[model samples]
Target: MNSDWLAGGRAELAAERILDAVRTVFIDHGVSGVGMTEVAEAAGCSRATLYRYFENRQALYVAFAGRETRALIERIWRDREVSVDRSPAQQLLDQLTAVLAEVRKTPHLAVWFEPANAGIVAQLANSPGVVDALAANFVARFRPGLSAPAAGRVGRWVVRAVVSLLTLPGSNEDEERAMLRTFVLPFVLDEHTVID
Candidate 1:
């Protein structure tokens, strides 16, 4: 039993080490440019060993993105500057803008925004786990009265908006802010509200 427990611990450690290697490779080469062989080489493991942890590049991408997304959410929550007293619309805008700025500044996370990898990132963002995290953060922190389903819907819209901005950025930050305020704020705050 002790030996089995040790083996499981070792396996978990190995998987985490592999993910660390994946982060380095993602930073060095954009997420789309990386492959199983590159990950294996970076991890100092045989291809077969790497495969034991991640079945394919897509699986690896999903895992990495999930990890990064969780970290980003935690960072957003940890930010002392994010005042809770702000209006729902203002809070959502602040959070969305903060997420965009953080992802752009973090090289490992930023690689996913490259045009080649945007589709993959968008697909991953739609996964239930990611959507739930976004919903929980938005509901519990920003809008306490929002229903779970409502939060999920709003969260997905916010994510789509963020992904769009990341993929095809506006002319400048001012323009981007204007676009979010004009297009996203109303819909996110009130589902029935339509923007003209």
Candidate 2:
């Protein structure tokens, strides 16, 4: 095999190994508690090798968030496609439930809320290329009257709210759903209250 091709294959494998390590670290230690040294040790690679793949801790966190975010968007899209007969509200509720549950379960999801991880949070807020694309597509389907930009903004807000709730210690599912209906959905919909 060509040397360039061999090197590229190895690089891809190394990247995967590092990402798997990142997942473990993020789960074991919250985003605020994890450091590059821990991630390197978890991956069984030197700090230099980890740095080559990720410039800094913030960059690694960004990659971690990006990976999980993509998986979530894909899941939502897949579920929606299968529910072709469902009403828009029902479809959206299903998608939101799945995505929110995953975010709550994923350790790195806290990255979005940690002030120290501002770099990662800025990436989500300022660029949000992946999140934006998913929002635009999904919003276009469910809320046709709203522009893509509006939907994207609402999507970001929902994500932020979810992160806030996830970071707290003891909010149950019923409480979360109530909070969503009371505090979140109404604000997005521009409603004064949750009628009935």
The candidate scoring highest on lDDT is 1
TM-score of each model, in listed order: 0.83, 0.69
TM-score of 1: 0.83
Q: Give per-residue CA lDDT, model 1, range 54-100, as digits (tens).
A: 88877777777777777887788679356658777777677778888
Q: Quick one: how many clashes does candidate 1 have?
A: 0
Model 1 misplaced regions, further than 4 Å = 1-9, 81-85, 191-196
Q: Could you give candidate 2's per-residue lDDT for residues 1-196 as a string of tens digits? A: 1224225557767777788888778667756678888988888887888899899876776666667777778876776574668655555556666667776565556444555655545555555564666655655565556766777776666666655565552366777676766676555555332222
CA deviation > 4 Å runs, candidate 2: 1-8, 79-85, 106-130, 144-146, 169-171, 182-196
TM-score of 2: 0.69
